[model samples]
Target: MPKLKVIAFDGTEFDLEAESGSTVMENAIKNAVPGIEAECGGACACATCHVYVDPAWSEKVGQPDVMEEDMLDFAYETKPNSRLSCQIKMSDELDGLIVRVPEQQA
Candidate 1:
């Protein structure tokens, strides 16, 4: 399992042990982390699961794909580091991944 840290808008931090191959959004939802809505499940159809990938992990986590980049147009306050949580699959290389929830979803 990989460890994940989700920082909420109100400053809540959710530390989770995530299963490999599952998504960051999945862990957040399963752990009841306060901020990931995952409205479209893991379909990559909505921006409700938006988050900011921590600067430290940005290079490894990488950028969103073309389809995801389009969907991010609807996310609130997107930045250079913005990513749809549902698109971030877990793996040992990504252990200790950190992300911050936006103030609100799209």
Candidate 2:
């Protein structure tokens, strides 16, 4: 399993063990990490699971797809590193993935 680190809006941190193939949003929701509403589950249809990929891991995490990009338009305070957590699947390459949940969901 890959390791996941989720930081909440108030700076609380959740260190989790993420199963391979599971999404960052899934891990956050499963672990009850606040700030990741994931209202539409992992369908890529909503921006409620918005997170900021740590800058050091941004390139590895990659950019969102067209559908996700479209939904992200509804997220609050998006940045170059902003991503819909539900779209980020875990893998060996993402063993130490780190993400920060937003203060508010879309």
Summarize candidate 1's per-residue lDDT along 44-64 as a digit string, tens digits. 999999999999999999999
What ranges in model 2 sit over 4 Å off?
none
Lowest lDDT block of 10, candidate 2: 34-43
Q: Candidate 2: deviation at residue 16, Å?
A: 0.3
Q: In order, how many clashes per candidate?
A: 0, 0
Candidate 2: count the clashes.
0
Task: Give model 1's TM-score versus the native structure.
Answer: 0.98
Which prediction has the highest lDDT against the true structure?
1
Predictions: Cα RMSD each: 0.6, 0.6
Model 1: residue 23 alpha-carbon error in angstroms: 0.2
Candidate 1, superposed: residue stretches over 4 Å from native:
none
Question: What's the distance in Å from true for residue 56, model 1?
Answer: 0.5
User: What's the C-alpha lDDT at position 58 in model 2?
Assistant: 97
